[model samples]
Target: MQSGLALLLIGIQLVYAGKHSLQYFYTATSGLPNFPQFVSVGLVDEQPFTYYDSNIRRETPRQDWMAKSEGEDYWEQQTQTLTGTEQSFKNNINVAKERFNQTGGVHINQVMYGCSWDEETGDVDGFDEHGYDGEDFFSLDLKNLRYISTVPEAHITLVKVNNNKALLEQKKQYRTQECIEWLKKYLQYGKSTLERKVSPEVSLLQKSPSSPVTCHATGFYPKEVTISWQKNKQDHDEDVDLGELVVNEDGTFQKTSTLSVKPDDWKMNVYECVVEHKSRTIRSILTEDKIKTNYAPVPIGIIVGVVAVVLLLVIIAVAGYKVYQKNKGFNPVNASDDGSNSSAHSDPKA
Candidate 1:
C-alpha cells in the first residue's frame, strides 16, 4: 500500500497542467543543525517547469523557455497553485517542529522528489518523501502529491495502525477525491514522455582492494535494469552482491553487483558484467580499465603468525615452570614414592 501509493502520487503530481518528460531536478538540503529549509528545481519536458519550495515560494518562467511549458502561461500561474499548497502543508511542519521540544537532536527536515517512467510498461511513476530528523513525517505519491497518508506522521504513528473510528478511511477519501482528477490529467499528459531511452553505461567498483568487484551501471532510464557477472559466458552468482536502483543527480538511475574474486581467480580478465533492460542489453568486460587491482590479501597469514607465536610462548612457559620445579627439588604433584600425597609443610630441599 505504501509503495504503490507513493508511485501513483508522484507520477501524477509533477505532470499537472500537462507537463511531459522530466529532464532533471535540482535539490536543496539542510546540513547545519536545526536548519529549516527545503526546495526543488524540477525541469519538466524542458518547458513547463517547477521551481518551488516548502516556504510557499516559486518562480515564473520567461516566455522564451517553451520547451518547459505545456499550456499558455502555466509558469506564471503555477505561483498561486504552489503557494496554496505550501500554505496548506506549512502548518503541519510547524506543529511537528513545535512538538519536537528536545534540544539534543538536530531538528532537520527534508523533501525529496522524483519523476520516472517505466520503459517496458511506458508507465510514468514518481516518488516524494518529506521527513524531519530522519524520521518520515509523511510520504507523497507523485501522482497524488496532495494525498499524504496520515500513517507516516511521527507524532501519531498509531493513528494509522490503531485506526478504529474510520478516521484513516475519511482521510483517504479526502485525499483521493482531491487528487483523482489530477492523477487522470497526469497520466494523459505523461504517456508520451520518453517512451524509450539509451542503455546504461556500465562499470565495476571494488569495495576494498581485496574484497569483491562491484558491477556498476549508471545513466539509464525507466528504472528497471539487471546486472550479472559471467565467466566463460556462464552465470557467476557465487559471492555476488546485488544493489538496487539508485537515482543519480541526473534523472537516470544507477545500480551495482559485487562479485567476489579471490587472488587465484582475479587473474582471469574474462569476467564480464552483463546488464539487461528494456532499452538495450549490453556487456562490459572486466579488463584492467574496468576494474582496479588494489585488492588486499586476506589476513590469514597474519592470523597464523600470531597463533604460532602464542603457542610457542605457551610451550616455553610450561617448560620453564617444570625446570624451576626440578631445580628446587620439588615434585610438581607433591606425591611420595609409595603413591601417597605429601603434606604442604614438606621441605623443598628434602
Candidate 2:
C-alpha cells in the first residue's frame, strides 16, 4: 500500500516537472505564455483530456484521476500524453490559421484569432472557430479530420491579434505590389483609345514680345496626350513641362502642360497639340489670326453730307470775286481816256 502511495507521489512530481519545463520553454521562445490561443475546458471533449492554460502555459490537473491506483509509469505516461497533445493541438491551430488567412477570405478574423479546439489522443479531435454573418464561412481539414466555422464579416481586429505578425507584414508588402501592378495594367488597357483623342478647346495664357507663349490645351484621355508648339513647320525647341496629372474617380486622366518659347511665335505660327499613346496619333492646331472688316451705313451718310456743304460755300465765294474784277475798269497802274493811252497804264477791262 505504501508503495502504491509512493508511486502516486512520484507520478505527480514528474507531471509537475514537465509542466514547469514547458512553461519555461514557451516563455523563452514566444515571449508570452500561450503560443497561439487560450482555449477553455468547457469547450473541450469529454474523453481523457488535457486543458492547457495557454495564458499561464500550464495544465489543469484532474485531482481524482491522479489519485487512481494506476501504477506510477502508467500515470506518468498519461501526463506526458496530455501535455504533449495540448502542445501539438496549439501548433496545428497556428498552422491552420496561417493557411486559411492566406486564401484572403473575409472571415479571417474568426479563422485566425481567438480560435478554439479539442485535443484528444495528441491530436485536434474537434474545433469550432467562427460566428456566422449572412454570407460567409470558415473551415479546415487535416488528414481525415476537419474543423468548420461560419462567420459574418472579416474580423480584422481578431486577425491583428492572433496573426503571425512577421508574415502579416510580408503580406502587406505583397498587397502593395499587387496594387501597383493593377494600376500599370489599367494604364495599359486603354492606351490605344487615349492616344486617338482630341481636345475641343485650345487656350493661350499670355502673349508678349519677349516671353514664350504659354499655351494650355485640354483634352480627353490625357494619359496618352502630348502637348507642344510648332513654328513654321519645325518643332519648337523650348522646354515643355507637364503638370500634375489628376485622375478622376471615373477612370479618366486629366493633365496640364506649359510650353515656353519666344512670344513672336504666337503672331502667325501654328501651335499643335499632339497625342500619342498606344495605337493612334492625333493632333489639333491653332494658327495665325484671321482679320475681319466691317462698314456701317450711318458713318457713310455723315461723310457725304460734310463734303457737300464745303463745296457749296467755295462756289459762291469764287463767283463774287469775278464780278468785282469786271466793275473795277479803271487802269490798275494809271487813269486814261482811251485804252490806247493805257500803254503806259494797264487797263483791268475796257
Candidate 3:
C-alpha cells in the first residue's frame, strides 16, 4: 500500500490545465499507534469533499458544498457503503500480512482509483491500483480490461480478479462511464469553488544577503501555474531550483522558485520572477530592498525580546511535532474477500 506520505506526494503532483478529476484513496493499516485502523478520502478536482474512518464509522462531508448539496439519504448511504468498505480493508490487510509472512509490526494496504476528464479535448482516463507497504501490488488496465500484477506475490489477486469477468466488466463500466458522470455532477455542484480562479500573492524572499532569492507565490486557486525566472530581461534557468507545488490549509496552492546568483551579479542585472495563472501574469523583481529577510540588525533589547518569543514558539512547535509524529502514516479500514464494492460508485447518489 502507498504510505500516507506517498499519497500526499501524488496529490501534490496532479496539477493539470482544463482538467478535472475525482479520486478515492482507501487505506488500511496494522500495528499503528494513535491512528485509525481504516480510512477513506474522496477528492474532486484535488479538493477533499468526503472523509470516512474507522473511528467515525460514518462518512462525512469535508467541504461545505458537499454538505449542502448532498441530502441525509445520500450521507447515510455513503456511510453504509464505507462501513462495508472499512471491513473489507481490514480483511485485506490480514490477507497481505499472511502473504508477507508478517505476524506483527507496521503494515499498510492502500487502493487509489480515479478518473480524469479534460474539458477542452473531451479526453477521459481512468486508473485503479493497489499497493502494499508502499509498493505497487496490482492495477487495472482499463483499455484491455485486465489486472496487471506488479509482483509475484500479487499474482494470486490478479488471477482471481481476472477470472471474474463480470466483476471486470463492472470495474470498467464504473471507471469509464459512471465515474465520469459523477465527476460532472460534482463539478456542477461545486462550480463556484472548484472553478473559481484566485491570483497569487507574489513575493521575493531571501534569508541573507548571500543566500539565494526565492520567488514565492501563495493562496492561488486551480493548482495549474508557472513560475519562471529572468535575468537581464531574458529567460533564465541556470542555477534555479523549483519547489514542489503544495496545497494550503485553505484549499489554495503555493509554490516557490529560487534563483542563485552572486549578490554582485544580481546588482548588475535586471532579474524578475514571472508567475502565470489563468489569465493573469504577475512579476516580482529581485531587488535588495524588495526582498524580505530576517537578517537585518536590530537594537540589543529588541533582539532579546525577539529571542524570548522565538524560544516560546519553538517549545510549542516541538510539542506539536511530537504529536504529529505519533499520528503520522496511513490511516486504514477493515478488509473483505471481495473488494469490488468499495468503488466510489457505491455511493448511490453518484
Best by lDDT: 3
Predicted candidate 1 versus true structure: per-residue lDDT over 242-319, tens digit per residue: 874444434455677878777357556478889998788989887656664542343233324433532221111000
lDDT (0 to 1) per candidate = 0.42, 0.29, 0.67
Stretches of candidate 2 exceeding 4 Å from the true structure: 1-165, 168-212, 248-250, 268-271, 277-280, 286-350
Off by over 4 Å in 1: 1-36, 40-49, 54-56, 59-68, 71-73, 84-91, 109-130, 137-192, 207-211, 268-270, 289-350
Pairs that collide in candidate 2 are 131-150, 131-151, 133-151, 133-152, 212-261
lDDT, candidate 2, 1-350, per-residue tens: 11211121111111111011010001001212323332212100111112333344443433233234234554354334334333433343333345445333321111111111111222111111222211123322222222223332223323432243443332233223332332233224433542343442334443333444334433343344555555566786567776543322222334445566544555557666554433355454543332111212442243344334321111110000011122211111112221221001111110
User: What lDDT score goes with residue 204 in model 3?
Assistant: 83
RMSD of 1: 28.5
The parts of candidate 3 lying over 4 Å away from their true place are 1-15, 295-343, 346-350
* Winner on TM-score (1 vs 2): 1
List TM-scores for all candidates, in order. 0.54, 0.26, 0.81
Determine the backbone clash count of candidate 3: 19
Residues 85-172, model 3: lDDT tens digits:
6665666677778777899898777667778899999988887766677666666788998877658777666665577777677667
Better of 1 and 2 by lDDT: 1
